[model samples]
Structure formats: C-alpha cells, structure tokens
Target chain A: MVDTQWPVYEVFHQQARGEPHIHVGAVHAPDAEMALVMAKEQYCRRQACVNLWVAPATAILATEYQDGDMFEHATDKSYRESWGYKTPKTIKTSDEETSK
Target chain B: MATMETLQDLDAPLKSAVIDLLYRLADDAIIIGHRGSEWTGFAPILEEDIAFSSMAQDDMGHAHAFYQMLHELGEPDPDTNVFGRKLDQWKCASLVSLSSERDWAMSLVRKYFYDVAESLRLDSLAKGTLIPLAQLARKLSSEKKYHLMHGHMWMPRLGKGTSESHQLMQHAVDTLYPHALGMFESTDADSLLDQAGVCPQENDLQQRWVAEVDKILSEATLKVSVQSSPVYGGRVGEHPDDLATLLENMQLVYNLDPSAKW
Candidate 1:
C-alpha cells in the first residue's frame, strides 16, 4: 500500500588501471550517493577495483541487437594493428641500403 | 586436548541436539534472507536496495553453509533442506517468518532485531565444542557485523527523516518488537547445549542484545516498550501462515520436477 521502493541504477566497475569499465550488475537506491555505496559493497567485496560508476538505468541510450550491424565497418582497418605498418620497415631497410 | 577429544566424540543425543540447533540457525537465515530478498528492486533508495540484497544473499549463504554441515551428518541436501521441508517442519525463529513486505521501516527494524540476536548467538557458537560448527560460527559472526552496521547506520537516519518516514519506522518497531523479542525463545535442547558447552547462557545473551539495541535506539531518540510475552513457535516448526506462502513461492520451480536437474 506504500510506495517505499527506490529507483534502479546500472553499475559499471573498472577492475584496474587502463581497464575498460564492465557492466557488473544493477542496484536500486533512493539517491546517487547511496547507489555508489551499495555498488561498492555488493560488487567489490571479493576483489580489487580501481573505480565504480553508477548511472540511472533509464538515462542510458542503447542500440538494439537488430540494429547492431549498422555500425559495422566495410573497410579493412589494418592500420589499427602493429603489423599493419610493414611499409615502414621496408622503407628503413631501403634507406640503409642506399646509405651503404 | 582432552576437552577437544571429548567434544570430538559427539554421542547420538548431542549429535541430534547439534543437528537441531543447526537446523534452527540455517532455517532462520534462509527464511529471513528470502523475505529480505523480496526488497531487491524495492528499497527506500537504490543504495539501500543493493545493500539489503547483498545482506540477504549473505544470510542465504550462511544458511547454505549450515546446511552443508547437516548434510555431512546424513541430513538432506541443501536444496531439499531448504525448499522440500513442509511448512510446519521449518525450525526458524518466528521473527523471520513474519510477512512485513512493502514496509521499509518494518523490514529495517526486523532486520536490526534479528541481526543483534544472530550476532550474539553466533558469538556463543564460536566457542562451541564441535570444531566444525565452531569454525563456521566464527566465520558467520564476521558477516553479521556488517549487517549490524548497516541497520545501525540507517535506523537513525530513517527514524528522524520526514514525519512520514519517522512515523513509519516507529510504527514498524512497535509492531515487530514482540516478535523480535521472540528471537530469544529457549530451544528445547538449550539444556543439552549448555551442558555440552555448545552455547552460552540464554539470559546473558538476551541481556547483551537488549543493552546493545537499547543504546542504539536511545541514541536515535527512539523508544520502544520491550514486549515480555514474545511469540514463540519457530523452533518447534509451528509458523505463521505467511511461511507457507513463502515456501510455496520459493519451491515452485524446484517442485515442478524434483527429480529433474535444472
């Protein structure tokens, strides 16, 4: 008969430095301050964690699985990998040959 | 060493008594934890909701550990021990089986009262004669510290919040105080447990619980008239009607096909 329930918040946790924040779970809290505390206790009790973030679940905009392919790339983005720059190695070798 | 050997040699009566006590402990945790978990998505705040859910999980975990010990003693598996038992067969304290849902104040007050009683009981069990149970009791005692802290931190804040909040909390305390006092109900095997050094004096435990809770309530500027005639049916398996409904809900999936493994 009473409205005592609070809002739900999505919890993201970063386990260590340079790590991506992963969605661990959700918790309901009346406010942001309380949500953070609950997230720390519920999620971080067993392991190390550098940081935690709590956002209202309703605030996040998410793409549906049906539209996931809309963001896929057609180009071969080989430049993103370390092995992609084989031309640099060849150029360095040519410079050394010319110097010799 | 002699004491240790004596304790290790648990005769049939002592074994039965220990099993009985363990069932009471495990069942109390299971029922209360289940009830508390109902607040999962519905606490006063998101933080409190999460915190309460975590506490509920811890309570259930503790019950599982106790059930494991009982299983070693040739009792039913943890699942059966928890969900398969008839309503009248559950050995939890009456306080745990009270249906106080949708009432945050009552939930907190009930939890506070139960935590105090559980902490004290576990403290006594930590010094028990049985080595395995004593070890488990010690571990559980640490977990209860956080539960107590959670209740203590919130009782005052919520008790003195808005007028509506304050009224709700006070009314909850008033309603649950008697059943909360039922936490101190004397188990049938208390004499055996006392003689075997399995638990400490009940009066001393009750006094300690009262003193600790009274101090906390007084600090919060809240007053409760401690009820003398506390309800007592849980230890012997007599429960309120709410427990039947609760068990039905909990066991629904399990009961669908008991022989089928999910």
Candidate 2:
C-alpha cells in the first residue's frame, strides 16, 4: 500500500531565555513550516515558552542502549575530581612558604 | 467586574440558553479539531504539518475547556459531553463538522475561514458578563491570535503562488465559502447572550469579520463571490455523515470502557 501519512517531526521547547531546549513530543507534517505551526499548537498552549524547534526524526543520531560499553566512565579518574586538588593545594602552600 | 451575584442569579431560560451556547462552542471546537488532526503526517510540508497538528490540538484543548465549564453548570461530564452522545446531541457549528476532503487548499481555506469566525466569536465571549466564561475566552482568544495569524499568512501565499496552487486555493475557497457563512448562524440564545452582554450582536460581528477577511482576500488577489444561502445545522445538532464517522473514531477507545480509568 502506498504510504499516506506524513513524516513525524520531533519537537523541542525552550521555556525561557538561557534555558536548554527540551524534547516535548512529536507531530507529523509534510514540510518544516507546517511542522512549526503544528508544534506551536500542540506543545505551547498553556506553558510559557520563548522558543520552539522541530526537527525530522530521521535526522537525529542516537546511541543504542543495548551497546553499553561506549558510554561507560572510568572509575580510576580520581585525580580529575575536586578532592584531587587538595593534595596539590598542600604542596603549593609548602613551596610558597619555603620560597618566602 | 460584574458581581458574582449577577452570574449566580441567572434565570432558567438564560441558564438553558447559556448551556445551549456552550454546547455549540464546545462542539465546534471538538469537531474542527478532529478534522484538523486528520491532517497529521499528511501536510504538504513538515513545518506546516506540525503547525496544523498543533492547531488541531489547540482546538481540542479549547473544546475540553469549554466542556469543563459546561459541566460546572450541571451538564454531562466531558466524556459524555464529547463521546457518549448521539450525533444529533452535538451542538457544534455546521461549518466545523464538514469534511475538508484532505485537500491542502481546502484545509487552508477552511482553517482561515473558521479561524476568522472563531477569533471574532471568542473576542465577544472574552467580554462576557460571566466571569469564568470571560476568563476562559480571554485565554482562548490569546491563542487564537496565533491561529488567525497562521491562516492569514497562508491565504495569500497559496493563493498567489503558482498557477496550479492559486487555482487549487481558489477552488477550495469557492467550495468552502458557502458553508463558511454558517459560522455566523445565530443560536437561540442570541438575545439572552446579548441582553446579558455575554456576546455582541451577530450582525455586528459578521460585518466586522467580512470587512477583515475581504481586505485579506483582496490583497491575495483573490475574489470570492459571496454566497446567498449558507448551510447551517450544528446549532440544532444536524450534521453531515462525516461528523458521525469522525466521532466514532474519536470515541472508540473512550466508549469501549466509559467506567475504566484510561
């Protein structure tokens, strides 16, 4: 059967200035202009929002949750955390005192 | 603001009239929203597809809000109000329940025509003596501005585009123009609404709408021959078959289990 339905677009909403655009929902439209109109009507009725964006679902590249290893973090990176700075702080203090 | 006492003191006739009017308004929004939703994923462009879908959702939302207001007045619950009722039980405007044939030109024309009518109607309601209705109208009116803008923007663009596009839009306008007049049909509660300052005179509203739309169409280089006789039935519950089919689809899940929490 010939496909009759339009393509679906993902909707994102920015609630206020400086806020990140969050994914709200999706709507189907034949073109981008129409999608923006539909997004405004579907997503922004009551909520206060300064901006909206709609993108084609096919355009997004998402990682699959089943392939988990790529997203894992290293547990041995303690030196990158704030606690690692404490050791350097003591060393710097001793060095400054000795130089003085 | 009129004192709450005035709103609370409505007579039986006026209350019935208000209920009748509310049903008409709510049903109009519901049916049109349903029709608009059908365009989902099928608009000519992705942006417009989202735009039309969003507009459709807004119409349904407005319907829900109106139905809630009616419920507070001792009418049926929103579920019963929208789904459980028979076709004849619906009080939407005839213009809304009519199908758009899924034609882009027709959809745009119908939307532009209806938005013009709805915006004016909502403007009148915003000034209603009834506080809650007035507040609701004001909120709806705010959103209507964008809806109207969307329609206004499309009318000229499509009407003046390519020859084929222009012809399609013109034909759509011709097809819908007669039914469009039905948007101004007066309910039996007209006098009651006017007396209570809930709505202005229909003639006044119609005249203003005509003047505004005429200006827009002229700029679009389109001339619409005004129809002498307009078809109207929604106020009294008469509707086309499409409305029945649409209601069947919309209420199928809801009707399956009226008592179940979905």
Candidate 3:
C-alpha cells in the first residue's frame, strides 16, 4: 500500500464576511469532513479565516493549462473592462440630431 | 461542601489535593503533548502531521494554563514546574508515555483514548464548583471538542479498513485499554476533591467515559476487554524509565541555555 493516498480536496478559504472563498490549497482526505479538518489545519494556520469550503479535486472543472491561448484575445476586447467606459457621451435631443 | 471562589478559600488539606489534581492534569498534557509533537514529521499523511502538531500545541497550551493555576496556588512558575521536573515527579499516566515507535495506529489509539478522558475531565471540572478552575476548564473544554472530533474521524476509518488495519487497530485497543484505565487511577485526593464539589470521583468519571467510548468503539468494530486491570503508578509519582528519557529529550534544548530567553 505504498500509494493508497486518499483523494485530494480543493480547499477554499473565506477571510471574512462578504469576502469570496478563494482557493487556498489542497489536502488529501477520505471525505469532506476530514477534508475540512485538514484544510483548516493546513491552509488557515496563520491566516485570518471566517469560513472554509472543500470540494473534491475531481469536482472542480477547469480549462486545460495548455490552452492558454484561448484566453489571449487576437483583437482588443475593451468592452469587457470598466476602464473602456471612462468617457461620458454627449446626449443630443431629437431636434438637435435632425438639425445636425 | 464549601465553594472555593479564590485561593484563600483553600485550607491545608484541600490545597494539597488541589495541587495533586493540578499536577495530574498538567503533567498528562505535557506528556501527551510531547507524544503528539513527535508525529510532526512522521505521520502517515502530511495533513495528519500538521493536525497532530496543532493538537500538540493545544495540549501544551492547556498544560501551561494548568501550571499557571498551580503557580497561583504557590507552586513554581509554569516553565520551571514543567521543564525542571524529573520522571517520577510527573503525574502523567503511563498511557501517554507508552512507546509508539512511530506506529501510526498506536499513536492514534493513544491520542483517541487520551482525548476522550481529557474531554470528560474538562467537562466535569468546568461544571464543578471551583470558580477559578471551572473558568479555566470551560475555556479548555472548547478546544477539546476539536481533538475529540479528530479522534472520532480516524478511529472508525482505521478499524473498519482492510483486514490488516483491523488487526492493527484491535491490537492497539487491546494493548492500550488497560493503560487508558490507568488514566483514572485514584488517590487520597479523590475523596478530598469529591467532598469539595470540585470534581467527581475518578471511578465515577471512568464509568461514564467507558460508556461514552463504548459507542465509538462499537462503530469502530473494536472490542475492549473490560476485565483488564489498570497498570497504575504514574498518579503517585511512580513511572517507567521511558518517562525519564522523554523528559530528558524534552528538556535538552532548554538545558543547553538555561539563562537564555526565548
């Protein structure tokens, strides 16, 4: 039994109320309760923690790391960023628009 | 029974009994804390290594709290009392000092047994009539819950695992049950403490502990021989050579620089 290592659970830690549960680390445990125990001890020993969440590593879906180019846009996609809306547009009345 | 609200309320005999009780609690924590700390680099899994180390720190902190209480009762400071004591001076049961030799099953069994007893002891002390001790016990009682949770999680998993694991857990339970009984080894202080409404009799607590632990053992599919007699000695300052060696190793670093501050 050199390699009967238990399943890994991805640990998520919430620092405080209204904060997102960020992926802290992973721990091997037989189940979720044990995973929580392991995750708290391993990931939150020195950090401020309000709560924790653990899901089996298998449950988390992710894009392949080799597909990095999928996230890189060949064209600029400034519409996705708040900075692209920095300028206020001038509103013209219907009459002004017709005169123009 | 008069309530001891403060140190001044303790008479001579009661003070002695209280000191005896404190030594039992403090020394057991110190010894078992060392045992848990030994698993720092050797646990079956990395998660367990960290968990055991964390428990070790909690045990040491509980020990320090008890020793502080002892110091208030006219004993030495916490550090001096814990680190300067010899083997026989320590009142920890031999169970905590039992040689695990890096056996994971043995260590888990020892910790599970000790945490059960410690939880029961803290609960009783917390509900007792001694104001100061009850306060400390109530605080320590909260931390014992996590240790008990750890114990509950692992015991059943190992016991109901493969056949070899089943055998390993059974062996550990059979081997350590008697020593666990040694945890409740009674003394003259029992009567004194009982009379003062401070804590229950050791035997009473042991019966309740057995009943409670029996359910978990059942779930673990392990049977304990109830007829096993306790190997009692540590309560009265009698101990094996292992304790001396443990104390020596535990104090070696401090001895290297007696005058240096951490």
Candidate 4:
C-alpha cells in the first residue's frame, strides 16, 4: 500500500511557567501548524500543560547509542559533580550543634 | 434581572424553554461526538485518529454534563435519556447526523463548520442568564478553543493544497454547507428563552455564525454561495433517516443491557 501518512513531529510540552518543555512523544502531521494542534490533542488532552512545541522529526539530529564513547569519560570526573563539593566538617560551633 | 440558577427558580414556560434548550445542546454534542468517533481507527493517519478521539471524548463529556443538569431537572439519567429516548425525541441537527462516508475532506469540512457554530454558541451561553448553564459553558468553552483551532488549521490547508485536495474540499463544503446551516433550526422555546433573558435568539446566533464561517472560508479561498434556504425542523425533532441509523449504533450496547453495570 502507498504510504499516505504525513511526516512525524517530535512533541515538547511545558507543564507550567519556568519549566522546561520535556519531550513527550511524536505525532504525524502534514505541516508544523497541524503538528502543534495534533500534539495538544494527542499528548496534552488529559495533562495540565501551559505550552507545547513540535518540530519535524526530520529536523532533529542525534548521536547513536553505539557511539557512547563521546558521552563517556575515560578518567574520574567526580570532581565536576555537586556531590564532590561536600566536605567533612573540620569543626562544629555550639550554635551549629544546637541547630542540627 | 437575577439569573435563573435552578429548575425550581423558573416558571412553567421558562422551565420548559430551558429543557428544550438543554436537549438541543446535549443532542448536538452526543450525535456529533458519535459521528466523529466513527473515524477512530479509520483516519488517514494515526495522529489524526488520536486527535479526533480526544475531541470525541470531550464532546461526549460535554453532552453528559448537559444531561446531568437535565437529570437534576427531573429527567432520567444520562444513559436512559441518550439510549431509551425515541428517535422523534432527539433534538440534534441533521448536520451532525450525516455519516462521514470515510472521506477525509468531508470529515474535516464538517468539523470546521460545526466547530465554528459550536464555539459561537458556547461563547454566547457562557454569558447567558442561566447561571448553571453559563458556568458549564464557560468551562466547556476553554476546551472547545482547541477544537476550533483544529478546524482553523485544516480547513485552509486542504482548501489551498493540491488540485485534488482543493477540489475535494470544495465539494465537501458545497455538499455539507446546507446541513451545516440547519444547526440553527429554531425551537418553539427560542422566543421564550430570549424573553426570559436566558439565551440569545437563534436567528441572531445564526447571523454571527454566518459571518464567522464566511470569514474563515474566505481566507481559505472557498466561496460560499448565499444560501437561499436554511434547512429547518431539527430543533423540533424532525431529522433525516440518518439519525435513526446513528442512534441505533449509539444506543446498541446500552440498550442490550440497561440494568447491567459496566
């Protein structure tokens, strides 16, 4: 059978203001405008969403999972993490002890 | 004047008018929702299938809310009112009863036409004197905004798309336009509702509906000939045979076992 469907669009939804638009799913639409409308009806119908965006799946670029070496670190990178900033207490004041 | 808040607040005529109006609204939602749902797994694309299903659910939900309000006014429950009522008692327009015929262009045009009228009607009801109906319309209108947007997006796209698409869209519009106009068929209660400050006159609503539809169609380059006649009788329960068939399908399961909990 001939493929009569439209192109795929990746949907991003923002739950509320100051929130990032996380990728929810994809929908097929003939154009960007229709894609956005379909995205709302498909993904945002039951959920609370303040904003939505859709980009053609063909427009997106990504690295293959097989190329994990680009994302992997060869050496220890724990110093770059926030958890590394925590240090054992050298001393404790009476005020700190009371607060704790 | 204070708004009518409940069925008991109205006199005999106003109560009757409100019931008539509620039936018109509820039947329109239920029937149109049913027709839209026939496209559930059959739409040209999966996304459209999902979109139509969502809107169908919204339409049915709105219909149920209206039915619930009627139940408070001493009518039977939603299922009974929807399934047990005789065909002659249904108040849905012929516009909603017509089958989509599995034509994508016809389906989109029908939705665009219906959504424009429904959006305008809901906006007017949102400010009307029936407080409960007004509150419900207010809530429902927000959800209908997306439905209107869906219509707005597609009507023009297919209208201006390829030669074949354009031809199909124009043909669908020409075929469905008269039935679409029938959505404004007046009930005997229309005047009573207007006099009681409960709702706008159907004629006035139709006028606004015409202007809005024309504006959108014009932008799509689709010409609407000035219709010489507006199809009527739906508001008073006269409908094409299509409604009978649609009701059979809609009430099939419920009628099979009215007492069984599902």
Candidate 5:
C-alpha cells in the first residue's frame, strides 16, 4: 500500500493567556496554517483553550528510547545528597580533643 | 418597533413566514452538514478531514438550534423534522444538496459560499427584531467565526497554489456559483420577514454575499461570472435526486427506529 498521508504536525495549546502551551496531540497537514486549524479542531474544540500552536513533526528533535537510560542517575553520587551531609550536632572542643 | 420575543407575537401569516424562514435555515444547515461530513474519512489530508468534520458538526448543531426554535413555534422535534420529512418537504438550497464526485474543491467552495451566507444572515438576525432568532444568531456566530476562518485559510491556498489547483478551484466556483446564488432564491416569507422588521429581503443578502464573495475570490485569484443564472426552486422544496440519496444515509438509523431515544 502507498503512504498517502500528509506530514504530521505536533500540536500545543494553552488553556489561558501567559500559560504554558502543553502538547495536546498531532495532526496531518500540508503546512503550519492548516496544521494550526487542525490542531484547533482536533484538540481545542471541546476543551477550555485560549491559544494553539503547530509545528512540523519533522522539526522536532527527540531522543531515542534506546538512549533513555542516559538520563538515569549515576552511581556513587550520594555525596551530593542532603543525607550524605547529615551528622549529629557536636562541637569540636579542645577538652574533647585533649581527652582523645 | 419592539423585538418579537416569542411565538405569541406572530399572527397566522407572520407565524407561517417565520416558520418558513426557520425551515430554510434549519434545512440548509442540516444538508450541508451531511455533505461536509462525507469527507470525514476521505479528505485529501487528515487535518482537513478533521476540519471539515468539525465544521460539519458545527453546522449540524446550528441546524439543531434552528429546529429547536421551530419546535418552540410548533414544529416537530429536531429529529423528526429532519428525518421524518419527505424529499419534497426539504427546504435546503440546491447548492448544499448537490452531490460531489468526492471533489475537495467542490466541497470547499460549497462550504465557503454557504458559510459566508450563513454568517451574513446570522449577523442580520443577530441585530433584527425577532428576539429569539437574534439571540440564537448571536450565540451561533461565535462558532461561525472559526468556520469563516477555515474558508479564508483554504480559498487562497488552493486558488493560488498550483496551476491545476487554481483551475480546479475556478471550475468549482464557476459551477457552484449559480447554486450558491440560489441560496437567496426569493421565497414567500421574504416580504413578511421584511415587513416584520427581521431583515432586508433575501436578494439584498445575496447582493452583500456576492460582494463579499467577489472580494475574497479576487484575493484568492478566483472568479465567478455575473452572467451565470441562479439555480432556484430549493426554497419551495424542489431539490435534486441527490438530496434523497443523501437523506437515506443521513436518516438511515432514524428510519430504522424512530422510537429509539438516540
């Protein structure tokens, strides 16, 4: 079968002004204008939406799933943690040092 | 004159004219909505598929609003008025009922023309003396604002896009322009609607529509001939055979079980 669909566009919409535009969904369109219209109909029509944006799916730079483990924490890094610095409340006194 | 806020404000002839206007409004919305929805799965692209389908839903909702208004004036419920009516009883303009050969250009032009007319009429009603229609028009215009936007987005793109596309769009306009003009075909209620201070006659609406359409089409590099005769008779319920076929699909489920709550 032939692949007859247009390019995909990632959709982001904001529920209010000065708010973040969260990723709502994607649509297939020839250009950003149609993509914006599509994003509106597909994602914003039924919801409380104040604004929308559409970018070509090809324009997105994404990490591979196989590289997902690269985001995990490295071992032997506990020194940076707050628990690593935890200690009893003790003062270093000259008397204690002399006794030692 | 004061606004006619309810059905009681209408005398016998005035009520008849009002119902006539309502039927035309509701019928046009329903048929074009049905036609637009045929592109649901088959549009050239998925986004447009969603767009057309979305507009179709809006049109249907508008139709429902008109039907509900008619019900307030003693017509049947929306479903029965839509599904139970015979082919000859339909008052939709021929432009809306005309079948497409799965042509996107035809669909776009038809919707563009109809929606523009709808928006203009809604504006007239929104400011008219029929208080209920005015209220409904004001409410529906918000949704219609986007629909007109969609038309603006596509008309120029397809008209100036490619040679073939431009020609296809031109052909679509030239072919459908007459039918579109038919949308304002004179009806018995035109005089009454005017006398009732609802709005000007349909021909005046048609003139404004043509001017608006002309300006937009010029911007899009498309043209419609003034010499083309308007296809009439839809206002009086004479439609092409396609309406019956379209209705068969539209009312298929309803015809199966009119008693069903769905």
Candidate 6:
C-alpha cells in the first residue's frame, strides 16, 4: 500500500435534470479538477448523473454528533411541523369562513 | 477524404486498413488495462487502489467497444479476440506490454506517457471519416479526458516530489521513453487511413504528443533525452517476453473455457 495518502474530496451528484446535488461519496485526489474527475469515474460510472461537485473534506464545516444540546429545544414547537395540525371538520358559512 | 461510414460501405483495402487500426487501439487498451489492474489492492493507499481499479475497468470497456466494432467488421467476438490468440498475434504497443512491477512511480510515468498518446489518437479518431468509429471515439474520448487528468495530476507530483520520488520518476521517464515512442510506430495501413481521413498519421500525432508531453515534463522540471532509440515492432505482432507473462496470467481463467459464460 502507498504510505502517503492524498487529500480527500467529498463528492456530490445530481441524479437527473432539475435534481439537487446530493452527497454520494468521497475519493482521494491531488487537486480539485482531478477530484471532480475521480468523483465522476468512481461515483457516477454505474448510474446516471447530470452533474457532479467536489470539495476538500477539510474545507467543510461540520457539526459533531456528540453536541446533542445544540439541537435540543426546551419548549414545544410542534406548530412548525405538519403533524402538529388537526383536521377541521367543516366551515360554518361562506361569509363566516371568509371573514377570518 | 472518403466518408467510410460502416464496414459494409468500405472497399476491401479500406476495410483491412480500418481493422488494423482497430486492432492496434483495442490491443493497447486491453494490455494496458491489465497492467493497471495489477496494482489493485497493492497501491500505497486504498483510494489509489480504487482509482486505478476503476480506471482499469474504463480501459477494458474502451477495449470492448473497439473489439465490438471489429466484430461488426467480421472479426471474432471480443472474448476470442482477447483470449483465443497467441502472444505474437497482438497489436499492442511495446510500452503497454512492459510490466510496471511494484514501483508506483514507474506505473504513473508509464501511464502518463500512454495517456497522452491515447488522448491525441482519440482526438484524431473523433474527427474520423468512419461514422461508427467516429461516434465511438467521441464517446470514449470523453471518458479518456479524466484519465488524462489522472496522469497530469500525478506526474507533476512525482516529478517534483521529494528526492527519492523525483529520482524514481526521472529514472522511469528515461527508461520508458523508448517504449513510449514505440507507441507511434507506423503501420503499413497508416497512409491509407490518413488518405481516407480515417485517422491521422502516426508521425503527425507523434509531433503533437511530443509537444504536449514536453510541456508537461518541462513544467515538472524533468529532462527528456533527445537521442534515444524507440523500441518498435509491437504493431506487427513482435513484443517483449513480458507480454507473454502478462497474457499467461490474464488469460489463465478464460483459457480454461473460452466458450464459458461468465
């Protein structure tokens, strides 16, 4: 095995037209263009892809999983989610419903 | 230039010329792909192993495409063309026939030279008069663009790297230069292919390749010899003993049952 490892580049791929680029995997490359090319050969060769992007792994700012408190909320915020809403049975009247 | 669209549309002489060119292209890809795959699981790092392995598959795929084109021209299937033939029957360049051994620097340098020549050849073929071959070359060239990137990225690193790496790279370059030059050895079909605009002359491609490789080597501060003799003859079926060993190992399984579905 090679003793020295090159820098890691995180690869992202857009599956088809009008699709968001999703993180697929990573590959080692000496530079950006090489990274993009390697990412294509490694990740997109077997599947269809419209576009690809690569960034140095070290360049990404990541939140650690151990920091659970950063995502915790003291108060209920269910209103922000669709599951919080209940079914409304009926409308009283066209005038009343349109009023408020 | 004649618009030789398909095998059926070609005259006898032109068809033979085209098949000769296809054999050269296909054999080079297959042999080099085998050499590259030899580095699998043995590269200094895991990622490099994966990278080389992936590119090997690309090389084989390109080879398969060329072989399929040959099949369309009335040659045997891809498997027989690859495994059924004797060692001297191959049309690969001597550069691709030599082993890379366990030296990563040598592999990189050899591939760098091979990749440059292949890129230039494919570029010419992409504009070829043969429609089916032209379309195939255009598609395969897109894939080869990345391979060139792989070579360009690594050659500089190895050339300008630390003392040991730089020494290794320079040595490999000096040693492999002749074999690399052999890649442009002119075949009897060259004039026919050139006249028909089916492909560029080897000399022309060689000139462009020299300019491109010279620029890259200059950027890397590596010195290329001006007076080394090229090791030719692979195009006409002559090859080094290394090719025999390579074939023995490559065809070990396929030779057992050439007709087996695997």
Q: Tens-digit lDDT track for model 2 on B128-197?
A: 7877787888999877888887887778877787899889988876777777777777877888778877
The candidate that achieves the highest TM-score relative to the unseen native structure: 4
Worst 10 residues of 3 chain B by lDDT: B80-89
The most accurate candidate by lDDT is: 5
Give iRMSD, candidate 4.
Answer: 2.5
Error in Å for residue B193 of model 1: 0.8
Q: Could you give candidate 6's per-residue lDDT for residues A1-100 as a string of tens digits?
A: 5555778899999999899999998988778887876787678778999899999999999899999788998899999999998755554465577897
TM-score for each of the candidates? 0.75, 0.75, 0.89, 0.94, 0.87, 0.89
In order, the Cα lDDT scores of the candidates are 0.82, 0.81, 0.89, 0.86, 0.90, 0.88
Candidate 5 TM-score to native: 0.87
Per-residue alpha-carbon lDDT of candidate 4 for residues B1-262, written as tens digits (9 for 90 to 100): 5788766888888888888889989999998898889988888777788899889888999999999999988889998999899888989888888888888898888887888888888888888888888899999998789999998898888889888988999888888888888988877898989877778998899899889988888878887766646677787779888898888887899888888887
B69-110 in candidate 5: lDDT tens per residue?
Answer: 899889998889998999989899999999987999999999
The chain B TM-scores of all candidates, as shown, are 0.94, 0.94, 0.96, 0.96, 0.97, 0.97
Ranking by DockQ: 4, 6, 3, 5, 1, 2
- Which ranges of candidate 4 are over 4 A from the true structure? A85-88, A94-100
Residue-level lDDT of model 1, residues B1-262, one tens digit each, is 1133333478889788888888988998998899899998877655567678889999999999999988988799998877688988888877889887688788888899999989988888778777777788898887798788778777877777778878888888778877877777787677887888888655667789889888888766677874546788878888888888899999998888888885
DockQ of each: 0.20, 0.16, 0.38, 0.60, 0.33, 0.52
Show pairs that collide, candidate 1. A28-B46, A29-B45, A29-B46, A29-B47, A30-B45, A30-B46
The DockQ leader among the candidates is 4
Write out fnat for all predictions, comma-separated.
0.38, 0.25, 0.54, 0.71, 0.54, 0.67
Candidate 6 chain B: worst 10 consecutive residues by lDDT? Answer: B1-10
Clashes of 5: 0
Q: Please report how far candidate 3 places residue B12 from its true position, in Å.
A: 2.6
Per-residue C-alpha lDDT of model 3 across residues B120-186, encoded as one tens digit per residue? 9999998887889999999998778888998998889889988999999999999999999999999
Q: Score chain B of candidate 5 by TM-score.
A: 0.97
Per-residue lDDT of A8 in model 6: 88
TM-score of model number 3: 0.89
On the 0 to 100 scale, the lDDT of residue B107 in model 6 is 89
